[model samples]
Target: MIVRHDAGRRPGYPAAAAVFAVGMAGTTLPTPLYGLYRQELGFSELMVTVVFAVYAVGVITVLLLAGNYSDRVGRRPVLLTGLAFSAVSAVCFLAEGGLPLLFAGRLLSGFSAGLFSGAATAAVLELAPAERKTRAGFAAAAANMGGLGCGPLLAGILAQYAPRPLSLPFLVHLALLVVACVLVLLLPETVEDPERWPRLSPQGVVVPSEARAVFVPSALAAFAGFSLLGLFTAVAPAFVSGPLGVTNLAVSGAAVFSVFLGSTAGQSLTERLGARRALPCGCFVLVAGLAMVGASLAVELLPLLVAGAVCGGLGQGLAFRAALTSVAAAAPAEHRGGTISTFFVVAYTGISLPVVGVGALTVALGLRGAGLTFTACVAVVAACTGTYLLRRPLPERNRE
Candidate 1:
């Protein structure tokens, strides 16, 4: 196998990062538009979470079955296919008139995200100079969250001010996907002499025993952090419109965008703090953010809610990036893709399962009350993780 080591050749990392961001951006373009869908389809709040969870379902399924495919098949082919999934998802949303299309679109988006999570990340890292690996990690994390952040921001701006809120965003996304496809085609393949493609089958969770200790705490932190994201992506808009009386789609989109922006900021902190210190510190911040969220729910305050989203998002970003970088660094090159996929499996589970719980609780507690309950639960989990990390921090090398 002849892996490219001449990072100086053309520095294709930027192009890879751009493709990563574009693919990821499409998955989240629907975040701020869920409310409009609810209105058009006349679905209950519970159904909204259900629609969102369906996407998570698709992501988790792909991670389990095909998460490591790129490791064997080469990065370019998997990325092209993932981009295709994203474009099809955009088309689904563009043609959406009811719940079925919503679910289908979300599922396809989830698949795209699952494929991107491991492949795009590996590609970006591989394309970077060894000396620039840290920077590459930042770029990858930023593209993931930054792309996600831009999604709502783009959709909200277009939806609030432009015509055909639903149709326009997807159309824009489809165009971006086309651009991403072109970029992928132009980039060199990272994996050299990859194994021949085999019949597809589930690549069940496989964590090396040596890495389990590090993986457990890292995965826990991710789970807690992602739960906050789930709350925002899946439910916060309803909270904004229903209780806070913010009907503007742009405002709601901005609110979601704030958390992701905070996350991007938080990821930048990881290099300075080291992954170990960053993890606990992030957990503490996450707890505080969740507290603010609960307070906002109680008092029905918009600023407090936004503050919570930002703080919690920053915290989530910090811990999540640290967790991902540390875990990816620890894995053997041969197993890197599968290990990263496993980490995402745990993280996405946090995003899906807890949000579904919140949705179910909404049936009885209403949105605000259920949101409060979620905030409390996640805060407690984060606090415990933080406390544990503080006492028994990962080794300094692992922390790197």
Candidate 2:
């Protein structure tokens, strides 16, 4: 077995992380190009958001249904299957058949992401030697964020500079998927024949009474943070192109990248701040970012918009980590898995449901007005979450 070929455990985590990153990067590879699709297809902004929401639907569906499938089979099989789905998604994009293909590609991308979310992360942690498990955890998180951040950036640069903007991004992703499959083949099998992976089924999120105090605030903070991320991921590109008149696809992608980069940077801060401090601190920072976004929409400034993306992303990263940490710590051991799943469901809902609202709002309010409205609403939610956390901090035992 790959795990016991030598005296020391193979440093398979790096490869596993690479595989994880590649899988997630495919999910967002289309962000910068939504404008192209809009122009080519003559679709409304609401359809754009609907296309994006389709991905989240696929993700949440798989998370609820097949989250434990990887455990039942083996990590490698699930990882490979995820990669296969990613490859299919790339093919769907490459087809460029219009809305139907676009939706299919995104939905397939979501399935790949959902599979990676549980399987790839667990694989990364398990591949590491016991001594390196902590580092492995960091790798898993970074791979996820880094992959997501890189997707738009890569697609943007390629689409802007390279020939065949839509086709090239998926072409490149398909090639990467090949490398990911090879890596997965080489990695050690983390799940034994008789493993007990978390059994996450169609059951709704279960927040036991004992965990409610921490769960309420933390989940709210996550909801708000994820909502900010959703806004950017779904519509920031259009906002950049429509109001700001920035035609460069690279610029749009960069704007989206900044937010995720900020989020990744913020998550690192949680390590130092601990759960008690980070949750409230992240909320306030997120509020600041949301206000900046509102101001940017009002004034129509590209730089301000970018800055807001990064700041809000940072706050999201911070609160997300702290919230997950606190919620997990608060839950009774037997019920922890279900509670965590519930937390993610809330978070993903924030990512999907609000973006659709913004899409619908765009019909009545102009893009700028709709964005302003969104920023105000999300900002208030974030601010309230922060204030609540400050007034009633998590227990000291819940500290990082």
Candidate 3:
């Protein structure tokens, strides 16, 4: 187990960020490959959504049950366990023969991500030197978006150019998972107590009383932002390959990557705007992105689709980070993990539920029609949230 010293210079923050990046990248490795699975497995769009929802269920379960495990047992143990789940997930994919295996693979992948989300973020922040806290936040956010973006791009390239398209990508990711596990071993642990291990029990979702007002708006913004991310991650590849006449896995992955790239760019601007202003602005930007996405579907324009990805991703990044920062600032230190987990539970629901609805809609309507429908719904939600945030003022100090 890696042990972090409270006094001595911490291990390199960027290094910790890199570890986080690789872990997150592994979580999204399946994004670009969904089309391949659909074709090979002969599953419908609805089935794909079901598979995706299964992953979300796994994520929610872990977050609800083990969200604060890292805090009690230390970051390294939880992170290592998460990576182990990733390894198992890759193995499931590699051995996949039917729908059950696919479900298992996604479920394991979700479990891995659920554990990593909180543990890795906390680890990255704590590993940073005292003066670089802000940079540390950026590092954490970048690693998340950058790594998620990289997953599809890497898988797409390997699956397109490399032999054994479906099998090879998972195998390559398994190797990367091994490397990440070793890196986690080398990293210093941030939690102070090693001996005081608590028996595992569910940590009920906790939100600070003071943060309640900010929580509603902030969580709503998060729901909208994550809903956008869910679209690309869960369904965009099928849309690209089906209606847009883009079949190459690499190209499909690049489309997904564009959104995440936009998110990273959007996050960089958060420092200049402050959290309150950024939250509403992000919602507006997301609506604009959704509009572009709708236009792309109407015209079958690939460039427009790419533009939508970037815009939507940027909007998600801006709103999500601001929401997280605000919620963290408002939450009491003692219940921080539970509060953050609760936040993510809501965010993941956004990621899972709306996309599932789109999948169901795709079964009746065609992909384009479903795309337009999703765009309209999300646009309405984002517009309303943006208006609410803009009309109200932020509390000067957290009530709690």
lDDT of 2 by residue, 1-400 (tens): 1232221354388999999999999999999999999889999999999999898888888877876677677788889989999999999999989999999999998889988998898888877778887788778888998899889999999999999998999999999999888888877776666345446456456899999999989989999998888888889999999988898999988998999899888988898999899999999999999999989988889999999988999999999999999999999988887788788878888988999999999999989999999999998999998998888889998998
After superposition, the stretches of candidate 2 with alpha carbons farther than 4 Å from their true spots are 1-11, 194-203
For residues 1-400, write the lDDT of model 1, one tens digit per residue: 4566464555388899999999998878898898898888888888888888988989999999997788778899999989999988888888875888889999999999999988899899999888889788889989989898888889989999999998999898888888899999888888878877765767678788877877888999999999999888888888999888888989888998889989999999887988978999999999999999999989999999999999999899889988987887788877776788789889999998999899899999999889999999999999998999889888677767
Per-residue lDDT of 257-324 in model 3, one digit per residue for the tens?
Answer: 99999999989887688887888889999999999988998998889999999999888888887788
Assess every candidate by TM-score: 0.94, 0.95, 0.95
lDDT for 333 in candidate 3 is 82
- Whole-model Cα lDDT of every candidate shown, in order: 0.88, 0.88, 0.85
Q: Predict model 2's lDDT versus the native.
A: 0.88
Q: Score residue 275 of candidate 2 by CA lDDT.
A: 87
Clashing pairs in 1: none
Which window of ten consecutive residues has the lowest lDDT sum in model 1?
A: 2-11
Comparing candidate 2 with candidate 3, which one achieves the higher lDDT? 2
Q: What TM-score does structure 1 among the candidates reach?
A: 0.94
